[model samples]
Target: MKGRATGGLIVALLTLMLAACTVVDLDADGKPIMPKDPNAKPGYSNQTPQQIAESGWASRVQQPAEQQALSWADMETKSHTVKAGASESVFVRAGGVVTAFDNSNARERHLTMTINGKPVQVQIGPVLRSNAIRDAAGFRFDEFTNQVQYAQLTKALNRHAVKQLPAVDASWVGKPVQALLAVTMAPGKVDDVVAIQLQQGSP
Candidate 1:
């Protein structure tokens, strides 16, 4: 009876061991492995520029207050130097026309204007980045060189009928327009304009 009981006990232990071996899955190093879902889709990490633009991802990205403050501070500091060009302030109001709008470089749109009786080339962008002034000011990309808008602006400028006009217009090509200009200080050199506003009134 004792020997029969011992054989039965050994069989029960073997069964438990077999069950454990079947149930417990382990890696080669003895760590338990996580079961992966077969229906999961693969992730895409690389996105093209067009894809990014279409996604409007940049507008969703938020900058921390501290970072934004710093950016504004830096912008102010740079603007101050330009602003100092004014005898009492950094902003000078002047009238001008779009003497030339060169879009030769798709990324950087160069606008040459006759301001204060001098030809000033204004650099509009490296449009790929958010730091572009034109983008910041809400100017449409095509408005810079749209032919219809250009013709209208030129006609208005030629008429010289409007004494006070808005600083910016979709149709202000050849018109006498005013803008607040930020001048850069350089020794023995004509100051470059850092910023401009197409004004619609006498300053």
Candidate 2:
């Protein structure tokens, strides 16, 4: 009986190997003939990044705080909050805050921002792991037909943000200052806020 069972196992293994080695038939164009599904959606938008940026970005950034953004304090207590994996635009005016520019990572130069009243760390970046600026710019998902269009928009915004900052030097380090931050937020009690437009001055 044991010998019969071993033979059956060997036969099963051979069957699986044969199935795994099945070759796909090719078409006249030398491409594999894939089975067609009627429900498949495989189209992307032909809209250019320059066209997209020109159409709506100016109006989005120019919108007033009352119309376009919510206060940082209001988003807490569950009243106004961006859901997890969602993004929101916020305009914040903070004074006497503790912050420092850490250029340790040349690739991701960012300021470690610690607002006095709020318990959140604000990070400025062209390449940080947050997409608040991209998502919070009043853009609808349907506007972008594919992932590529969405990604390029973020790159355009980052270029604009880098121009908004003062020269990367020791002029504003460890000083008593005020900051007006137009930033984006994601869900959670307090974490990182990606600043879209940041302005600073001595208090």
Looking at candidate 1, the ten consecutive residues that score lowest on lDDT are: 60-69
Q: Indicate the TM-score of model 1.
A: 0.32
RMSD of 2: 15.2
Give stretches of model 2 more than 4 Å off: 1-47, 64-67, 78-93, 96-98, 118-120, 126-128, 176-187
lDDT of 2 at 11: 100
Candidate 1 Cα lDDT to native: 0.41
Prediction RMSDs, each to the true structure: 16.2, 15.2
Candidate 1: segments with Cα more than 4 A from true spot: 1-89, 126-171, 199-203
TM-score of each model, paired residue for residue = 0.32, 0.59
lDDT of 1 by residue, 35-70 (tens): 666985432224332333234222311111112222
